[model samples]
Structure formats: structure tokens, C-alpha cells
Target chain A: MTTETKPGVREVQADDIAAKVAELCQTATHVLPEDVVAGLKRAEQTEKSPLGKQVLIEILENVDIAKREMIPLCQDTGTTVVMVDIGQDVHIVGGDLHEAINRGVSKGYTEGYLRASMVAHPFSSRVNTKDNTPAVVHTEIVPGDEFRITVVPKGGGCENMSRLQIMLPSRGKEGITEVVLRTIEESGGNPCPPLVVGVGVGGSSEYCMLLAKKAITRPVGQQSDDPETAEFERELLTKVNALGVGPQAVGGSNTAIAVNIETYPTHITSLPVAVNLQCHSARSKSATL
Target chain B: MPIVKKDGETRATPPFTDEDIAQLRAGDHVRFYGTIYTARDAAHRRMVQALQERKPLPMDIRGQIIYYVGPTPARPGRVIGSAGPTTSMRLDPFTPALLEQGLKVIIGKGGRGSVVKKALQDNKAVYLLAIGGAGALLSGTIKSMDVIAYEDLGTESIKKLEVEGFPAIVACDMYGGDLLLAGKEAYRDQPALGDYVSVPPAEKAG
Candidate 1:
């Protein structure tokens, strides 16, 4: 085949990535998303326990305060997680993509006055990374020349509550339901309820978790396009709410405002599932360049 | 409501005497004024290590409340950045030791472990809840901030905070009353008393 340049291909400077990533991080931390705000408002109206209602009310106030003042919704500004969808036709110039993203994270955290929560080592030392560099990046190449980035600052509390498991093929839908419910029950209020539970089924173990994490990046009430998956989400949500974990786990009916499920094809021999919980804050933002 | 400087107000700040803690119930709303200390996982690790070596803690923690927070840095003209409570469970390992040091109160979000609960009872201490994710709102209540120790740890460093109308609710009280548990149980036992319109039989029994 003869080599020829495509006419529609575009060049994107790495500086552009850094600048946009910084803004995305800053925006995600300072403002709770609109869907989440609406969800909390509805919870406040329907919350059954007086204390639970009061907690919901305070949470809404917190959102308002964070937005009006341009400060983070939570002190734990969280680990900077960036998801990049780079069009295959776009050529990124000026610098390495990962380095540019990290620089952007540092700039965002510093300029926005957000907390730096990352630690260097896991088992030993556990020193702070200072500027919150080296963000976790997940990238996908798609058909067009457009570049998109989604920034999710995931807090330690709810991130710690995330779980993964390999189940026997026999443990299908009912088994999945059992495990999901049990996870929320065991989680209680520690993940900072009311939680948004994200579940990923099938795929390899690692991809399963990635799916689960990505599920939370979607807006709070958005459900799967598949009818079967949406029904399952509704059922799991009902059972989770039935746990009585309530707002901040203090008790009421809103243990979980939503259950989101994402599925992928997997090897016949392997049945993997991952459950990731997003706390009430549920902060994320996205931009296309 | 505006919290005034009064002796019997439930929302009063510390230095809380044993009498003050005794009067508190699991669900009572309180507003903390005066000074409270800040620390999270890293600072707690260091403090617990200091305890092991029999070294004095960075500050006098006796009869004081330690808030689990690693705040965002303050911008220009701000006392502190978004300052809200972190999850308290991560500090569970060090809590009993701090309780032994006469730490009278712990403030953060979410529930504590059984060991911490036992420690609170033994130390005549209480664990309170600041609404999680309300950092910007809560930071409005802070009047001043000062880092006291572990400065290199950045956000995890030990700092002191002075707050006004710093709202909190009693989650676990000195008398072994756990509001989180009570709150869950109350709703489970009698659905009518809670905000839920209905409860399944399985959960009601469990």
C-alpha cells in the first residue's frame, strides 16, 4: 500500500493537553456535577429519617458552598485520574503525552489550591508526592481527530471500599446480586454514603475493575442502554437501599441513589466482577478538544 | 441557629469536661467553636510511632478533639482551603493509643471500628460526625489555621484549627451509645419512624 497523509488529520500540541487537563481537574474538584446536585436535592425531599434528611440537607448546602466559593467539595481532593480518548488521526506534538498530563495535574492542584493526596510508596515510606503528579491515566484511540479528557478525583475513603472478585460461572445473576448487596452492607457508612455503586461483569479481572471505575464517571442516574442491564441495576439499587445504610450510613432509605453496571465479553472459563463505590461527592468533569 | 457562648448549649466547643460529654447523646447536633487539631493517616502514623517511643506528642492532646482532615492549601485571603472531615476508620489502629493519651474527642465522618468504640468508652471520649463532602461549607466555619508538626508531610501535617459554628453530630458517645447503629436499627425496627416508605421482611429481621 502506498503511504499517503490523510487530509483531515490534525496536530494537537501537548501544551494544549496539559492546560485542558489542569482546568478539568480544577473544575471537577470545585464543582459537584449537575446530575449529582439534582440527585441530592431529590434525596433531601424523600429522605425518611429526620437525621438522614438533615444530613442530606447539609450535603446540599455543602455543594452550594463549594460552587459559590470555588473550593473543593471535600478536603481529600483525591487522586487525579484522567481518561483520555485520543483520535487515531490526531498527532500529539511538543512532548510525551503522560508527562504532559502529570504536569497538568501538578498545575491544577497547585493553582486551584486543592489538596495533594497521593503517596509515593505503598508498603514502605508512603511519602506524599507533593504536587499530586503521576496521575492514573486510561487512554483509548478512536476513529476521529478529536481528543477528549475526563478527570475524576477519587477520594481515598470510597476508593478503599472498591472490591474485585472472581466467581464460578454458576454464580450468575443471583450470585452477583448477593455479593453486591453484601459489599454495600459491609461497607456501611465508611465509604461516605449515600453511595453510587458501580459494578462491572465479565472481562478479565483488571478490565472488570476499569469498567467499574468508568461506570461512576457517567452521570448519577444514567443507566445502561441494554434493557437487561438496566433492569438488573434497578433491582440491585432497590436491594442496596433496603440495607438501611442511609445518608452517611446514619440510617434512612437512601443508602444508594444509583447502581450502574457495565459489562464486557469474557473468556468462558473466567467470571470476574468488580464493585467500585463513589461517595456522595461523586465529582468528575470532561472536555473535548 | 446562631451558637452563642453558653454553658449548657449542646453545640458548644471544647475544652469539654467529663460533664459536657456526659450530657451528650448519640444524635444531638453540636457546633464546635474554639480550637480543634487536624491530622489524617500520615500524621496519625507518626503520632502513634511517637507514642511507641514514649516521646511527647507534637501538641497537648488531653481533653481535645482531633479532626481527621488533610485540607487543600489556602488561597490568597483565605484562612484555609476546603476543610472537611475524612473517613475516621483509617485511623482506627492509632485511635486506642491516642485515647490512652487522654484525647477526649475524635471528629470525622462515618463509623468507627469496634476497637475504637471500646477505646472511646474506656477513655471517656466521644466520636462526632461532620458531614462528609461538605469541606467548602465547613471551611467557612474555620477562623484560623496553623501547622504544628510534620510540616514535610504537607496536607497530612499536624495543624490546629479555630472554628465557629463548626457543625457536627454525635456519632458515638462516651456512654457506648453509637448513633450510627441506633439510626440504622431505628429505621430497621420501625419503618414508620424512619423516612422510608417501606422495608422488606428480610432486612427488618436482620
Candidate 2:
């Protein structure tokens, strides 16, 4: 294919994208982001139960060991979720975008010695896809000439605990709080605490779920830019901690480190909400090409 | 001998007797030594199926401990990699049956269901909680590993593991004490919100 001659257009090689993605997958699984580490430290200080404090200490130690030894932070290394924001002015040369991403995922998991958690058949055979291929990739076209890819390796334990609901608009903030609290309580110790909860409000069902997932990709302590949303996040975080599901659900005052909320305008009759609970590992990495 | 310390941390080896299990209480810390078996969702399902068909199990599980984990592939010159616990509740259905067969201890992350708790109480077994997501640190405790059965299952295969100073907490004991419930009760700043709020089912779009 001939290269486009448009001015200010960036031509990026598909192979370079694959290489960067491969490096990111390995690095992200090995080292947690700094913000999450800080959150865990804060949890250790704030935890009321002695046992909970010990658990947080161990968790922090584990994080350090994982980074030092270059091993995965968690055994569930998880399903690779790749989110790409491609600039409309950039041209991807040499291969299909998705194929390159999957190639990168396969290379990263196999060469890095990460677990192959993906199974080929969900219902019947449930066979393991040994290489952990065909990552769940989401792509969006944006205004700039920059291409950004964020890889989130979501573990099944916490991902399974996530929930979404279409609520009556009348339920409002109280209803949303109740749903978030119920998810955390019912989840108990399964999702691993201290959790970073992501809440999505006021969109269609599927869109809200996406929003919740995106909310988690944001840094742990950063709040919503909107003041009202930030207040809601703080309020939800308080009630969730009050549930006393504590670190590892052994009960403590620091059940969750942060609550992040994202909202979108929706139909008058529906108030769709989704809660995505992230374990203490909370691993994600992004790179721009 | 059960090595119960004043600090609530106990050190014990597997092939534990009822006396050893009896000495443990919910919320106490434990450091395990010697051999343990690794199993998770797939391995448990197959073991339960074997019991149903009246076939001999791949190994003698009597008086043994099962750790719910699926570790990453070990790199060159390593015995294991990131060996942390998976959630235990998924094995709840298969656990009671194993406990009935003389399985003495279960090691994993998270809480067990009522049926499993009753089984532990009746069978004098116990459940231990390992640190979830703390895989690398836990890997340091494991000295060696060998796959004994169902190698084709990849990471889900049944393996024999030799560990030293493997840390965990007593989550459920034979005396009906559950740390998950008790700990949460102690730390809760306010009463629970009673029943969960019910949301109406979504309407099908035309």
C-alpha cells in the first residue's frame, strides 16, 4: 500500500506497536502503578483490625517482591483487555491492527512465562488456549495524531464480583449507594481488599459497564473532575469501608482504598449503574506511540 | 506437634491429626511446612467425578491439605512462579465430599459457604486463608513442586508442593468459628443496611 501524502499525518509501523504492547504486558503484570502502592500504604495505616493491618503489610511486601524478582503480581495474571485510542490522522502500516495486538499478547504471555488463563470454549469444553490469545481489544478514533494503548489484565475473582443494573430513575443517589455497598458486602473477601471500586452511572446498560471498567484504569486516588461526582465517590467510599469487609475480608476500617465514579447522560426512564471491583493488585499500563 | 505461639501464629506440618486441627482457632496465623497438594476449579471437578464413578483417586487425599492455586509457568532454574491462592468458594461443592474422605485442611483465599463450613465441623477439618494477590511473596515459601496428575490441564493440573513457613490465617475452624464473619462484625462501624436493594429486571427492547 502507498503511504498517504497528507501533511501532519503520522505513519506508524504495526510491528513497533506490537513490540511496545508486548513490553507493556510484561511490565504491567510485574510492577504495580505507584498510586496503588501508595493506596495500600494508606490502607495499612488506617486499618483498625490488627489482622487487617498485617494483611496489608503482607500485601505491600508482596508488591515489592513481585517487582524485585520480576514475577507476576498475582497468579491469575488475568485476561488481557487492550483499550486503544487511535488518532484519525495516523496510518497503521504492514498489518491489521487487531492481529498485531493479539500477536503482542501471545508473545508477552508465552515469552514472559505468564499464566494462560484464557479458555477457548466458555460453556462446553472449557479448554485452555495455552498462549492466552485474542485479547479483548476496544478501539476508538480520536482527534490527535497520537495512538495510545492501555492494557488491563483483569483477574476473574474480582471481575466476577462486578455488577450492573438498570434502575428506576427515582432511586437516585441513595439507590446507587445501596447497590455499590451491596456489591462490596456480598463480594466480601473474594475480590481481595483493600479494593479500588469503579462505579458507572447514568448510561445504557452496556455503556455503563464500559464506563465502570474505564474508571478503574484511572489512577487510584484521582477523583472525578466534576465536583459533584467527586463528592459522590467520597461518600460511596465511606459507606463501603463502613461495611467492615476489611482487608481480605478479615474485617477492618479500610475495606476500600478508593471509589471512582463516571457518569453519562441517559434515558429519563432508566438509571443504569455498574460497579467494577478491582483487587489490591490493580495492574494496568499505558503507552503512546 | 502444634507449634502455637503467644502471638497467635502457629507453625505446623501437614498430615495433621484432629488434635493439631483442634488447637487452631479462627483468626490465628499459621506457618505451614512439608507437603501439600495444589488444585483449583478444573481439578476439583475431575476429582469429584472420579468419586462419583467409584474410581480410585489419583492420590490418597486422606489427612491431606489442598491449596487452591493455578500458578504461572516457572522460568529456567526456578521451582515455581507466583504461587498464590485462588478463591475457595468455587470449590465449595466439591469440598464437603473431599472432607468426608479424610481431607484435613483446605488452603485458599476468601470464605467458604455454609455447606463447606458444616462439612469442616462434622469432619474436624479446617480452612485457611492465604494472602490473595500476594503471589510472589508466597512463591518464596514453596521450595519445590511436581505435577502428579492431569498434566494436560496445564496450570490447573494437580501438583505436589513442598513448602516452608507458608503463611495463612485460620478462616474456618472445626469448632464453627469463622474469622470472616467475626472479624467483619468486630470492625463494622455501623450496622449492616439489612437486605440489599432490589432492582427491577430490565425490559426487553422491541
Against the unseen true structure, what C-alpha lDDT does each candidate score? 0.84, 0.88
lDDT of 2 by residue, A81-151 (tens): 99999999989998989989998999999999999998898998877888888799989999989999999
lDDT (tens digit, per residue) of candidate 2 on B26-91: 998999989899999989999999999999788898878899999999988999999899999899
lDDT of 1 by residue, B45-77 (tens): 899999999999999998898999888899899
Model 2, position B76, has a per-residue lDDT of 89
* Candidate 1 similarity to native, TM-score: 0.93
Docking tier of model 2: it is acceptable
Q: Give the DockQ (C-alpha) for candidate 2.
A: 0.37
Off by over 4 Å in 1: A1-5, B1-9, B189-206
- Model 1: how far is A258 from its true place, Å? 1.2
lDDT of candidate 1?
0.84
RMSD of each: 5.7, 5.8
Deviation from native of the Cα of residue B93 in model 1, angstroms: 1.6
- The candidate 1 chain B region of ten consecutive residues with least summed lDDT is B197-206
